[model samples]
Target: METKHIIITGTSRGIGFELALQFANAGHKVLAISRKTPQALLGHSNISCLSIDLSIEEDLEKVTQFIEHTWKKVDVLIHNAGVLLLKPFDQISAKEFEDIYKVNVFAVANLTRCCIPYLQKGSHVVTVSSMGGIQGSMKFAGLAAYSSSKGAVITLSELLAEEYKEKGVAFNVLALGAVQTEMLQEAFPGYQAPISAKEMADYIFNFALTGNKYYNGKVLQVSSTTP
Candidate 1:
């Protein structure tokens, strides 16, 4: 298999961390971005970690510079970092809602823009979304901000796909279901998810590489149960 240069965000833990590990284990080059770089990922030669808040506009320069100086190109870019705000709609503050959009929506757009010059034909851009973002899907309380932000990214990816279609770069969204992670635990206390973070990462890893061949501007609902 050809070694791919992959950029993944939210890699400090959960599915993001597992995706980085799996890609590196398969002999691909991985740039893992998060607020904190995990000690475990440091041991892998194939993995490079960047500690930065994606919500910050200037912090993204570090990522673009790294790609320009090191990889010179990107085969896949995964927008996986997201902030979840689980609070009553009536009680959620304006700042809190904007904060979630900063990371979940604006960051994705900013990072993708920075990556456009580096993305070549056959490159894929995958945005990780949530089932709650899907229209007519099962809605949950306390996810007004989170779900809406996720939904925004879904539309963003679709528009991007259309804009970049002629360039041969593909854009897709994965609306994931319940997965056992720190985020899930914090969001729904004592609620056991049917799938593990590593399992979801495995699916995402494969899809990030080859899904563009069969799909573009598509949103895949990767959930086994209604959430």
Candidate 2:
């Protein structure tokens, strides 16, 4: 297998951490980015970690510099970091809503822009979204900001796919359902998800590697439940 250089965001825990570990263990080089580095990922020969807030523009340069001075190319870029804001529309403040969009939507766009030059043909860009983001999906009252941000990224990926189609870089979105993770627990306290973080990460791992061959600018509904 060819050694691919992969960049994954939101690796502090849950699905992001699992994705980083799986890729590294498989002999692929992984650059894991999160606000806080995961201790368990340290010492992994194949994994390099960066601690930065994705919403911070200047902090993103560290990633670009890392790629220019080190990896030089990116085979896959996964936008897995997201912030959730669960509040009634009326009670939500503009600042709180903007905060979610900054991390979940704007950051994805910024990071992808920084990595565009390094992405070549056959490169895949996958944005992790929620099932609630899909049109006509079961709507949650409290996830207005979170779900809307996810939906925005879905459209953004589609547009990116079109813009880069001639260049051969593929972009796609995965609208996921309930996955048992810290984020999920925060969104729905005491609720048990049918899938585990590791399980979801495994699925995303396979998809990120080869899904672009059959899909581009597509949103796959990866859910088994309504919520």
Candidate 3:
């Protein structure tokens, strides 16, 4: 496999961390960004961890500049960072909604905008969305803020695909179902997780490397029962 410079957000732990590990193990240079550096990634030769809170607008520019200076270009950009605030609709504070949007929507847009100039042909832009972003099942009550933000991300990816298709940059969204991650634990405490983070990571990494044009602008849903 040819080595590529991959940029992944929300890599402190969970799906993002696992994605970074899988890509780095496959000989790619992975730049993992998160609010704090994970100790497990301290000495990885193929991985470089950047501490940046994507919710902060100022940090987005810094991250983009850092990537441009260090890697010059990004072959694969994964927007995997997100937030979930489970609270009653009436109890959800304005601050909580703003926080979720900052990380899940605004930050994604900012990062993608910054990377556009540096993205070249054959580069892939993948956003990690959610099933809630799709059909909006009523299984969960306190997920209004989180689900709406993810829905916006899915829309953004589709729009980006259309805008960048002529330039050969592929854009897609991964609408993942329940997976065993820190976020999952927070959402469903005391319940056994149905899927593993490693499993999801492997699937996503393989899909991105397939170089298939069929997946461009597609919202691929992954669940335990689907595969």
Candidate 4:
């Protein structure tokens, strides 16, 4: 595999951390961003880890400038940072909904915009959503805000694909199923997933590397039956 400069968010732990590990271990330069730094990722000479909360608007600009100066163009840009809030419909407030959208949608949009000028012809932009965002997926009943934000991300990816296809930049969204991670545990309390975070991360990393070859402007719903 060629050494590519990859940018991934939410790398404090779970899927994002594993994504960084896999790419960096493969000798790729991984620009891992997260609100908190993962201790293990620090030892990798190939990974440049940034501890910045994407929800903050100012931080987005800083990331854009940092990537501009450090890497001329991003080979793979993965918008993997997201927030999950399980709240009943009646109890969901504007602030709660906005907060989730800021991380899951707005931040993704803003960062992608910043990277547009630097996106190479074959660059791939992948957004990590949840199964909750898919129309036919089984809903767990309390992820209205979270799911809606993800749904918006799916649409955003499609729009970007249409807008950038002429430039050869591919955009896609992955509606991921339940994975055993801290976020999953918090959202579905006590639930066990059929797959681990590392497993999902491996699949995502490989898919991000080549999914655009056969697909773009598509939402690939990846799921495993849960008992």
Candidate 5:
């Protein structure tokens, strides 16, 4: 297998952490970004840990500049950092909404824009979205803000895919369903899920490596049924 250089956001925990380890184990060079470096990933030859707060535009600019200086191009750019605010619409403050969009939509867009110059043909960009992005759940009483932001990410991925298709760059969204992670536990305190972050990470990494052209611009939903 060819060794690819991949950049992944939210690597301090959950799916992002697993993805980083899996990619590095597969002989890929991974640049993992998060607010702070996790001790577990402190020193890995194939992994470069970057401290970046995606909510800050200046920080993202610095990251982009660093990537441009250090690497020729990124083979895969995975926007996996996100925030979840579960509160009633009325209870959702302006600052909360801003925070959600900052990390979920704006950061992803800014990073994608910055990476365009460095991204080569055949490169893939994947956004980690949620099942809420696809179908609304009335059962989950207060998830409007989070759901809306993810929905926007899904659309953004589709539009980006079309815009970059001619250049051989692919944009896709993974609408993950009930993955067992810290985020899941926080979202649904008592709920149990069949999917684990490791399982999801394995699928995502394989998909990134072997997915066909037809998979571009699609929202691939990975649920309990998914393997």
Candidate 6:
């Protein structure tokens, strides 16, 4: 396997952190971005952690500069950063929806667009969506903003895949099920998931590495029906 230059967002914690660690451990150069740099990534030679708030447009400069100077090219770009707004649809304010969309949808779109110059043929872009985004899954209450934002992410990625198909840049979305991560814990306190963050990270890492051959423009729903 070729050593890849990978860019991952939301590496401050949870599945994003796990993905960064897995990539670094695999000897890939990982550029991690989050609102704040997580201690676990600090001082790691293989991992370059950038403190960038995706919710703010101004913070994207740091990422742009890194992609411009550091690698000059990227093998994989994973938009794993997301914000969850668990509230009744009627109670969800416009501001709350905007916040979630900023991180979950717009951030992914903007970053992917900006990184096009850095993306060579055979490169891949993966967006980490939720089961809540796609319909026909277990409908949980209080996820209007979060779910809708993720839904838009899926649509955006599909369009990107077609737009870049000739360039060989593939785009895919993973609608993952419940995992034992901070996001899941916060959304459903006291709920236990058989899948761990590390497990999901491993799957995502492998997919990001080579799944593009047959999976471009696809939305794969990953859920454990182990009931």
lDDT of 5 at 119: 82
Clashes of 6: 0
Residue 86 miss distance in model 3 (angstroms): 0.8
Tens digit per residue, CA lDDT, model 1, 30-96: 9999999999999999999899999999999999999999999999999999888899999999999
lDDT of 3 by residue, 1-227 (tens): 68999999989888899999889888999989999888887688999888988987888777677777888888899999989988999999899999999999999999999889888999999899988888644346899899999999999998999999899999999888888899878887976667888888888897787744567888988765422
lDDT of each: 0.96, 0.96, 0.86, 0.90, 0.87, 0.89
Instruction: Flag the better candidate by TM-score, 3 or 4.
Output: 4
User: Model 5 segments beyond 4 Å from truth?
Assistant: 135-139, 225-227
State candidate 1's TM-score. Answer: 0.99
What is the C-alpha lDDT profile of model 5 across 43-70, one tens digit per residue? 8888988898898888878767777787
Question: Cα lDDT for residue 220, model 3?
Answer: 83
- Our model 1 lands, by Cα RMSD against the true structure, at 0.7
**Across residues 1-227, which tens digit of lDDT does each residue of candidate 6 receive?**
67899999999989999999999988999999998888889878899988888877778878889889888999999999988878899998888888888899888888887789999999999999988888667777898888888888899999989999999999999998888999889978999998999999989989999889888999999888421
Residue 50's lDDT within candidate 4 is: 84
Per-candidate TM equals 0.99, 0.99, 0.95, 0.96, 0.94, 0.97
Kindly report the root-mean-square deviation of model 3 from the true structure over all alpha carbons: 1.7
Model 4, position 121: C-alpha lDDT score: 86
Off by over 4 Å in 1: none
Residue 94 error, candidate 4, Å: 1.1
Q: Per-prediction count of colliding residue pairs?
A: 0, 0, 0, 0, 0, 0
True-vs-predicted CA distance for residue 149, candidate 6, Å: 1.0
Question: Model 3's lDDT to the true fold?
Answer: 0.86
RMSD of 6: 1.4
lDDT score, candidate 6: 0.89
